[model samples]
Target: GKEQKQLASELARKGVTKEQAMRVKQLYEQQNNVNASNATGTDVNESRLREEMKENTSDMLEDHPSTQDLARSNQVFGRNIFNTRNLTFEPSVNIATPLYYRLGPGDEVIIDIWAASQNTIRQQISPDGTINIQKIGPVNLNGLTISEANDYLKKTLNKIYNGLNNTNDPTSAIRLTLGSIRPIQINVMGEVVQPGTYSLSSFSTVFHALYRAGGVSDIGSLRNVQLVRNGKNIATIDVYQFIMKGNIQDDIRLQEGDVVIVPAYDILVKVDGKVKRPMRFEMKKDESLSTLISYAGGFDADAYTRSLRVVRQNGQEYEVNTVKDLDYSVYKMRNGDVVTAEAILNRFINKLEIRGAVYRPGIYQLNGKLNTVRELVNEAQGLTGDAFLNRAVLYRQREDLTTEVIPVDIKAIMDGTSQNIILVKNDILYIPSIHDLEDRGDVVIHGEVAKPDSYPYADNMTLEDLIIQAGGLREAAS
Candidate 1:
């Protein structure tokens, strides 16, 4: 009752009048008090029952309604909220056989000289791109191949070991071998997922760097991915080509301080009219008409493949005569282009009329070339039981613009006695009813008549006589 009174007060504050609020409070107080006491007028038992219900509800809530169990039962993985199109291009990576490893800053090398004194030393290149050796001073090793660095180090060390003129000797007094390569830090910016600076191995390619950066995002374009080094675009990678057919020519090895900039997807083309997957497709660079068609899951079976046309953004129309010789090179596509694959047109004769006692008589379409009367009758599920087979008439229009009525023997044709007649376009076949009773002379009394019905024929059946036979017209009838 106190809770009900508080709720009524809230309702009064929310636009209910004071009198109405009091009435609602009193009504709830009556209902709540009605079940508060037993027939003996004692409320102790009711209070005990309420406490037991609360305990039971609390126990039920704690037993099997665990949040972790509920979440585990409903958890799902790999469920994408947005539709993703799988579009892959040929891979075109230009790579050669392993030849030489270049020595740069952070590259380690071990130098061993086997002479009067055994001198073995391990040195890493300094920040200035040089390595300091005993008696050889600082030697620039940046951008020098392993073979070149080894030769330079040998030539310098030979000056201290033997004589500089002894460089022509094939046998060197010192032996050097390349050690570990340093990790490079590159930046992946723009529309890629988790774009940031990533530390990778010096031998890592562009694909490895991209994988570390979480690859491109949903809106990222795969066509014009730019690789920037020293504020210049070193290469534009088309991952579509690599994805379609292992042609990773542009998957260049990443250098230190390299930046991969992925731009937003910009190209979009719409496909409609007799396509299996008719939807707007996001296009990659150098995408042509053929590529777009394939992106739309190819043309449908009824598609007029030869009659493909495209409407460009500027309203310019382009058509391809044949899909056989369709060279995507010649028929390039652009953004906002609308491509349509027309359907094969219906050209065969299709209209015919069948009236009277035939079992499903109506105007039917004879789409086939050799549409005969037997086929048309079969299509209508044959004639009715009361059909006059002997008096069947076939009315055809001649080329000279005259109607020709030909009597057909349907019974003989059905029994294989006579050849069934071939039907033409726009032919009308009528089968009369077998019950050829005399035409009853009657007058139809309808609309504005008191008794709207048919009256039998008389010697002189006038409109007045018909009206009299149908009973007098009411006042509302005219």
Candidate 2:
């Protein structure tokens, strides 16, 4: 119960819900019970179990809703690549041996010789880098490629076997192939999820070692993963190259006792709003804003490309700046910078809307040919016959952004009597129908009528006509 409470407290500190904490505690107890039951005579590897427990806890924490919320709230990108359960990134053992694979201790080699007599020999390289032949004594195969080892073995065995060097003879042949591969111990240090020494395959690369170490940590730099060999930094692996362009040219093969170090991130910038893929990205020292945007998959379709806004932290206070399109390539990005690309305004530039009595009443373009009201009407197939040509209302926006109603004399404008008003952007012209101007009321006939209802009133109608329209008077009528 105490341990469960402690676990609950830790999860609570991480913003986990009470129900989630209980689920996590239940899983934890189940794991502990399993571990306890298997503790007897199982020869369990404590380090591997610890790593498994850590991975399980990480998986549970990653599944919490708060984790996703944190990720969307400007959390560092590429951190969750290692937190996934699907991609193990384990090295394949069934792949063909690489030509550049150097022979090392504990590696098994198979030698097949056929010339007048057939003989096959299997030898494992010793710790002293030498393999004992049947009659040729020990030959050092370590630090040599497969082709190099084959050439050396042929020269050493030519004294006992004839025609060994003859390439023209079809029956005479010597072949060298790798058998069971060896294991190499590597140390994965610095900002990685799990920093420890792992026994990996001799053919393993830097990526394989990283995967075995549970990948880089949340604060680690993927762009500068360094490979140290024999106290020297031999190579630097940039994961971004593989992620962005699928280029694995820098994923060099790992040697025994090699050290893979993931350093803390150098510079990070967040890009959100109107971007194809918005997230926080790690930046190199010399990378620009354009490179960062490209890493974010560029701007979205509705993005305002003319300029971008940047909120930068300048030591004591935050400073905001506008970056124009021309400066994107040259603008050097700094750490803790937030870049935003806003969407374009919803309003249109050369648009005018016509409602009510036009033939084709809708929106029209305010171009040179349709600049005047009369031209707009002509473009709309002229006003309808019932259109009130005496006065129409044109709604225009003033410079102060207030709506202004202008009374238009349509008859005079159509007849070329008055000056035609030029239309501007967002001008709404409304022509009313003549029926909308007349008051068409109805007459109500009640009490004494067979049907107590209202009917449309006509001019100079008598009460008898009104009663006839209401189905005449009833028997109880006065």
Candidate 3:
């Protein structure tokens, strides 16, 4: 009871009522006492439990069910907090060709002479399997590797020099160097932002290559990322584990001219049928379907939450058997996944229609943003022809499932001012045809202007600028 009272005091300090705290403390003490008695341990129920709780006020209890679940599947290199990004782990040097190896045709090399820069070189063996150096002439080293070629060169140099200069220490003086293999560039495609050739000076992990290619696409997921090599799907890297658990093994080393493609975030849950807002939505980081749906504008009035379906897109397509709750969204999304919220028995969501003179004209996605029209217009290619640059409408469904349209202004775009608007996906932009448009601006006629319409939008016009040609702007004009 005294131990229970101390626990109550601790609880009081934590803003937890003393009554419930005392109750749980007593129950715990009784359970412990009974266990001790049965074991013949004669251990008394001391105040240690209360003291422990007090000492650990900042740290969460290991016994917390939430914490246990968090640690469920996060173990890399025996550390749950390992970072896959910076293995900081200089993995056992990936001696590409065992370091001091030789080079051949198709094998890259760098030769640097300590005494002379002209003699030192960084180049690949020619197709003819020969290298032409400044002083050494052409050396036939087609089949030899880096080491073999160096030895041959040393022997030849010694033979010639000893005969002429009478140097006894010929072999020991020559120091030939074979530079590292030329950097290997990998082709990165798919959903990456800056997709291009990335050089590989040394053996680097997948993440390193990705950094070179400018990180993954915004919609790309680290979880279930695929790395294909030699026209074969060699490995599927777990990006999340690399992220959460710091797994570096997944960051495999890359080879020359390897194509690293980042497919678009394919795993998507479709909010269709009866969802309040229907569209394809990406699974947020460390998020669930419950959170995702809420972000998708919650369940439609007719949405039957119990009948939700998660259709995932792999290479082709496959329907997940069934999903019980939002936690199912945690299932690593692949390239494409459609999550559908079935219509409820008695309710129905209203339909919206969009059309206009815009970049891409279509029934675009509707997120109910006032400026979403601008985004759709840009996507469709901006307004063409004689588009109504003045105003746009926001059509929304009322809680009663009825439609409401609100008009918006967009003249600021023409002036090259104001922020460009973001288009909600799937929006319809109507564009008419456009004719030629002309504009006249400030002008200066220093030399001549035949009809006085020559000077236009140009910078730093001087007397020489006016007389660009021997005849000037024109004979009569000048």
Candidate 4:
């Protein structure tokens, strides 16, 4: 009791009122079952209790967090989910067409010969990789490019169809054109949904081959996707660029022996705060901030998009930085970057707090002289399904610190029977939720009645009517 009095005196000296100090002392005494009247008890039980209390009090004091630690814990960059994983390739979106696409068997070619009599022949490369032209017989076109084949065919045809004119000079003209190119067999291996060799059109790209092989698997990394030609890595594919901005720079054309390798997804970045979906998203190398945001389902309606933050994963901690510019496409995202979208805090002097029974319940910006309760309600998407609009209360804090609770009948105002109330700054509009219909306007019957349950109160309801509705009085009724 002496120790409790000392603590109460300390609390009172530190600005706690006598009543609050007494309450705290009484609460402590009740919780610990300590008697203040016999504070200096020397019983063995009292000593043990005092020791336990001392141990618990010491532990609590020791566990109390410092201000600096609290501040650090409350920082926005805390709780980052990004992992530091080295990326292999930076995403690129500049695919150049293969200028020397090889000709193979099954490729069709058109040959035109003009010598004495014009003759045109359409032929396909046989399985032996040779084309049989009229008169010229078989010509090997295996492993030849379009330009090389054209040159080779024209030279051979011109020589065979050469016919001397009166001047004794060779007067043969030959035209060669490539028809349908043969489908190229591409091997799609690695972490794709289906890994196998697929025959795609000669014009098919790496993405097309991936599609033919059922695309990358769920655990596949689009950023580290590799295109290998003849056992050599040709290009890195970053599908995010194509997904976000329709960029196909890395969608290089596939060739025979080309392999589309979808490696396992290993890079991750975290996105939180004011976004439709806040979670850790897998990212490919060279993806921009805009792509990451799109992956997270874009910004929320309440997001302050003007300025967002990114917490870069440093060795043992995170480095937070704010990005004020809205052009996120140009900013390349790293693997361990945490993107955070801030919400607009109602810091302006002209604001209203609209709470409960509304689609959007928060602080709303108010315009002077022009802002009204109806306009604010409309901005909040009107009332919720269970809103009690008839009994809406508006709490206004006066300059002298006194609060005025004004009852509002929103249904009457909407029906044009009541005047529209103009709302001022700092007004708190609370729309109550609908209660159980049976509990509304109810009257409770006390003891001595047959049924002591509450009944719905009606205009001019007599005690006898209530008694009859409550199943009448019991025999012991007073």
Candidate number achieving the greatest TM-score relative to the actual structure = 2
Q: Give the alpha carbon lDDT tens digit for every residue of 298-352 in model 3.
A: 7766567774677764565576746776555564444355667776565223222
Cα-based TM-score, every candidate: 0.46, 0.74, 0.28, 0.49
Q: Which of the two, 1 or 2, has more TM-score?
A: 2
Residue 18 alpha-carbon offset, candidate 4, angstroms: 44
Query: What tens-digit string does per-residue lDDT give for candidate 1 at 65-84?
Result: 35554443232111111123
Regions of candidate 2 where Cα sits further than 4 Å from its true position: 1-70, 115-117, 167-171, 381-386, 411-419, 434-478
Please give the distance, in angstroms, between residue 379's alpha carbon in candidate 4 and its true position after superposition.
19
Q: Point out where model 1 deviates above 4 Å.
A: 1-100, 110-122, 134-137, 157-169, 172-178, 272-287, 294-303, 309-332, 338-478
| Candidate 3 wrongly placed segments (more than 4 Å) | 1-124, 127-183, 196-205, 228-230, 244-247, 250-253, 264-478
**Superior by TM-score: candidate 2 or candidate 3:** 2
lDDT of 4 by residue, 7-84 (tens): 656554445556655555455566456544555653755666667655644454455554554444333221121121
| lDDT agreement with native, every candidate | 0.70, 0.86, 0.54, 0.72
Error of 2 at 431 (Å): 2.3
lDDT of model 1 at residue 295?
63
Clashes of each: 18, 0, 41, 4
Q: For model 1, what is the C-alpha lDDT against the true structure?
A: 0.70
Q: Which regions of candidate 4 deviate over 4 angstroms? A: 1-101, 114-116, 162-181, 276-291, 294-298, 306-338, 346-395, 398-424, 427-478
Location of the lowest summed lDDT over 10 successive residues in candidate 3: 73-82
